[model samples]
Target: MHRLRCFALCATLLCPSPLLAATVFRCEDPGGHITFTLQGCSEAQDLQLHRAHNPTPGSGQPVPLAQTGKTTRTRSQAKPSAPLVVGEQGDGCGNRVTGSARRTAMIRQQVLAGMTRSDVESALGKPDKISTQNGRTRYHYRDREGSSRQISFDDAGCVKGKP
Candidate 1:
């Protein structure tokens, strides 16, 4: 279903129309999952709109998009039921993670509670902001537009607070 929606949106948006101003939305769900949609991020505080400079011929009517349901997936393509426990710096053993696409997907699914500061930084890059309270520190990272998530570390450095 998600793939279908994305494909439909891409088809419609990719269809050039002089009178149409396409609205592409980048959304970060409450759980911090990221998605691009045909409509706006309903609850996003950091929405951005991009308009095509070139115009095509159309009466401003939105293009019709195909709505094919989800396609079958192979075993290898399946996501893990539980995210792998990565190393303190990303992979379980001490190492700097690489691979932009894979790293990003992994970061999105990482379990933060046990992650060290270096692991978080290596996965998500620098935090947008940092603060401390009662001897504990928090790191805030921004996602898709305005969505933000934070990880707090207790005195011993394990993430604090419920996920």
Candidate 2:
């Protein structure tokens, strides 16, 4: 009985506790800049609260994402659960500039969030300089006015934040 009690006490002391959980906020400003932080955002920006906890190994559950209204094509879902379409406000992806080809051509005149490298290239023409680091790609451009602009893309080749 004494050995059992000692073993139990040692196991209680040595075994790791569950990973710490945290509350994160995803905020997007009116201009379409997205930021994730522990601190909350101002009322102006759209805010989303995400409770993150590290599940034990072999839990067989996926990590939770922010509950945007739109449905995503998850591996487990046979069909999209929600009836929302792409480019909607609550979609997991950011606000994309979508419309008819002609309208999109006009929209692409100015770089915006949720654009692809090809779209940006078509809008602003080829970049003057290109660099890649940490799986992120950046394009540097010099306009006729001698001003400079830089756009960055994530590993998935989509624009990151607002330009």
Give all candidate RMSDs, comma-separated: 27.4, 23.7
What's model 1's lDDT at 149?
87
Candidate 2: residue 50 lDDT (0-100): 93
Instruction: List runs of model 2 lying over 4 Å from the truth.
Output: 1-95, 100-108
Alpha-carbon local distance difference test for all models:
0.68, 0.79
Candidate 1 local lDDT, residue 61: 57
Evaluated at residue 114, the lDDT of candidate 2 is 67
Q: What is the TM-score of each candidate against the true structure?
A: 0.33, 0.38
List model 1 lDDT by residue over 73-140, tens digit each: 99999999998887444444223234454456456856345555776676678889999998988888
The weakest ten consecutive residues by lDDT in model 2 span 88-97
lDDT, candidate 1, at 128: 94
Can you tell me which runs of candidate 1 are displaced by over 4 Å?
Answer: 1-109, 161-163
